[model samples]
Target: MRRMQKLAVLGALMLSGAAHAQSSVELYGIIDTGVMYVSNVGGHSNWLADPGTAAPNLFGLRGTEDLGGGLKAVFKLEGMFSLNNGASVNGLFGHETYVGLRDDRWGTLTAGNQIDFMFYSLVVDRWGPAFPFVSSLSLRQGSFAGLNIPNGPPGNGSFDFDRTLGAPIPNSVKYLSPTIAGLQVGAQYSFGGQAGSFGQNSGQSFGVNYHIGTVALNGAYTYVKYPELNHGNDGIRNMGAGASWVVGPAELAALYTNTENTENGARVAVYEADVTWTFSPFVHANLAYQFMKGNETLKNQKAHQETLSVMYSLSKRTSIYSGIALQQASGGPAWISLVPGPASGGSQVTGNIGLLHVF
Candidate 1:
């Protein structure tokens, strides 16, 4: 009789815990904005407008339900929009919305739009944020900066493609392995979604990362094949490797990327190194240098840039910043645009002043 009573109490406690876990959810997001100025672009100087936010304006929701026995159902819904232009980041396609299952012992598997393994690897390898711009630099420059053009794919008006934000993949399924003694692995695939064509514009990628104490290392590879040749034949191939070290309030990072577009027979390589020094809880400084080569604006051309900036945090969620960047292009004028397109002109300097808020 006593044993039966104890078992009933235990079961009741377990049910209560499960019920509490199932009802928990979290809402989070970051709001960043700023103003930028550029000189010597196109034939005349121009005033470049920036998104009110330093990064893409965004908001997201995350939730989890515990099923007991070290198993859980998890999901995240996130949408990105431009605060300045009031436009969706991905147009009609959702940016990063996914649902998945996670097992404490097994791993996690998710389906929907998400980041690829290569982009994630760049973050793991580099300290602080991926690049000086709003997003990871790897998106603009591949594995090694020199392997491909530093700013973007080698071509006319390539500088327009430079974005300080990370680009998420569409129609993606991703899996992340449980950490095994500080070692982790991740893989993802993006479906082309063409009727009756399984691999028309599909992409597959994978990466591995290892961290010990304050030192970390990572490597990744990605292949995007557009079989139809509508965009290009042989598609685009990107591969990258990076590393980061963190000590006290200072961190250092370096990365290299190679991006090739076989359809047009154009290739660009980029190399980058960055350092951040935190003087106090509210003050920080950043210095970065990037180099690009191969088929720049003109065939067999080259260009390079160095950027530096500093920020002072007023509070945990708000800060003010200022920065200056110097760019010099060879082969032709490398005009800078918000999105990858045609450059207005080249040999320029850019400055920005802004405030950022996070929630």
Candidate 2:
């Protein structure tokens, strides 16, 4: 009788263990780096360590657990690090660390450090920073005097597609609504977390998207506050919209962003258009043009950027690419180029061959 009781208890424990094992976890990451030459830095031609304008290097743990009914619990912990020096990022998991719940019929609500609604749009314009070769060049000029630039890529910081406030807001909570009739919407808020002020450094953003057939559209707005930068608090208010069309092996996309500094009232606008073509299962090409106009439009202070990227896949997780990036300015400040110059009439050009691997 005692032996039978013990076996019964053991079987019950095994069943419980199996039930708990229904949860799943995954480890994923990407690494990309390259080399290149800069036209003029401090009036001298320079060849330097070009950390390819690809994804930031990172690794992360993400998992989901199925609860009863149609609900599920989800969590993600990811970190950014430098590939050149192998140094762990201070964020530890600051890149994207969050916990939440989801339901197919309902939606998803997550809390922690996360990107804004515009950054997460499913139909995000393809004219973003993730393109090959010229991504770093784009990021270098992504910022203005008082505004912020969206962080680029999943784990890397160099190449992001869209230009927005790049830093993930801390102490944040977000909600994503389920798609209804090809339309999806999301909203997010990040508490300032200040000791006594609710509006000091907080941020709020919302995005709406629509997709039908081979066409998709996106629109987003964000307000980010900066408290410590200047004696008086400052921030950036942004509004953006994008559209894309897909036909056969080619897709065309256009994105426009306008940003205004709260304290200085400086306005900076960027317009981008891109074309992507897939030649085969293993080959692809992308061509793009970007124009940035800043402050008083009357001054003719603007910059133009162009990029061409050609890529070949070696496997599902590995690829090689070569890209050419060029920048020209007519009346913009030196801020428009990687070199130290308002070189009113000069231009910057770069080329690189790089590789990327994911697992």
Candidate 3:
């Protein structure tokens, strides 16, 4: 009888210990699609279904396991897909895949494919008032292909040059510091994975953020080496700063970014400002303006763009939105980022209406 009682006590202890260590997993996603009307594309007006205007079509799995002693293990896997034809935008889980350990006092340290500070600081942290409002359509892709960014996507070498669209940095490690007195900092490094060259294709990024009261300030810098450029010695460099203020139901923000291709002496600079206002629990609106300019290597290309957007919430996870943007270019052809093609003229207008659902 004593032996049986000891066995029972051991089993209870095991079960109790198992109960102290807990883990959870969650699946989340967003689906957004709409009809877009472009005034001109390759000299013709067109209408088509577009994705990722209000929000990118993406899904992700996030999990956490308590490790006791104020520590936890966490992981995230995220991917993007096209809603029009149900095709993967990148590879499966190409957007973000990371595993890390978090501690209550030390913040988090993660390793895997990840985004750099450009997106985390400038877009996600500082540009809250302009993000989905100005959307990806207003990001900045012009006729500056003369920059000759080797291996760049077909077109001007400056596609998403500022890296504000969350471009993935593969084989990377990152550290996020715990917020201290309303300030937080982050850094990341990507491995080149070259046989004998450590710097080839390597990249590094750093960001800082501070918030006090209703005002927030952010800044970041990133340098990514491209093996195709200068024998992997030179690459693209980016730096940006932004600030935002909240008052009542309105948010006002401004941002500036500079991008340079060291191999070709190509450079582009952008300035932007925006405002978002909430009229009610279900209604919101935003207005924004942007100016982009390139150096002599790009024929002194310059562009001016303005955007307006409105959203109506049906519930916490569903919303309908509409947006309109106008762009004019001087010294080059006009092209809106995410649009299929460049306009035949120097001016273009685009309007979109879309539905978004989150789960």
Candidate 4:
């Protein structure tokens, strides 16, 4: 009886070990909160403050299982939400969700609501260095705020996208190329998912990036011509270019983007610059600005906006910040918006402050 019992215990231990070896999962998140004040607006009022809360408020799970030699299968599921109000960002899954196979030599092939090759390049260029405050928060103010281009034309002359679309993109498959001599390329396809209208609503995008020493450059092109859903189905074309350089204790970057909307012959062009300086291992600051120009002939067009922000880091994942910004509208109604975030809807703003924590 004792021998039989020992055999059973060993078998159970082996099964548990095998399960642990076959899968690995991790949970990660960030809590970003702050306060914002907007002037010359009608919604809420004076000294208005709350958690800048939703900046990077997100949680995610990721795991990988070894398949074989130089190969692995991986998956990630992430969601973004507003901590103050307990509301999720966009889709059912929220931010990003995807699964794919990766090989040392062949690169990675992923499907589901993955990121666009071009968009990823631009976001990285902005976020990698400054770590300004939190992605969802910092970019909403000042010059950096102009980079906020919606997936669809602004309604009533407001530059907001249809976050209800679940994701800016849907039914997507992506391919990433292996890097060669510091150069990498990627492509993506989004299916229209419509009956008898495959070609009518489908879209394609491509991107290329190069890095050498302390300087890196990236460019991307995207074309979408979906005319079936009446959401300006005539389509839109986007092109973006950006460059970054590191020198001594400072990192500098510049970005330019152009979008042409076919349905109405409208165009939006944006220019931005970002600089970061690390005075010490635990102390650093960032400065950024952007300019936006829309079709002046369009009623309620966006005339101009400017923003500036600075922050002091308490640690690698924690910080306190303060910022001041201004916005002016033209043609029609005034369009001085902040972040359109839940706190303020990225509406026009006058001042802001807050704290951020990441884990």
- What's each prediction's TM-score? 0.80, 0.83, 0.91, 0.79
What is the model-wide C-alpha lDDT for candidate 1?
0.61
Pick out the ten consecutive residues of candidate 4 with the lowest summed lDDT: 157-166
Q: What is the number of backbone collisions in each predicted candidate, taken in the order shown?
A: 34, 12, 1, 19
Expressed as tens digits, the lDDT of each residue in 257-327 for candidate 3 is 99988998889999999898889888888888989999998879998989888989899899999988888
Worst 10 residues of 1 by lDDT: 135-144
Top candidate (TM-score) = 3
Q: Give the Å shift of residue 304 in candidate 3.
A: 0.4
lDDT for model 2: 0.64
| Model 2 lDDT per residue over 1-359, tens place | 12322332343333334445777777899898777666654455666555645556888877777886888877776777778887776456656667778899899988777777545552233333233322444443532433333332332211232334244666678898899998888898977766777777778888888878778888988887776434225676777888878888888888787766666566767888878788887888878798877676225356788878788889989988777777776553333223233222347666777788888
- The reply for model 3, stretches above 4 Å from the true place, is 1-21, 128-134, 149-152
Please give the lDDT score for candidate 4: 0.58
How much is 155 displaced in model 2, in angstroms? 22
Best by lDDT: 3
Candidate 1 vs candidate 4: the lDDT winner is: 1
Model 4, 246-270: lDDT tens digits are: 8988888887876665666666666
Better candidate by TM-score, 1 or 3? 3
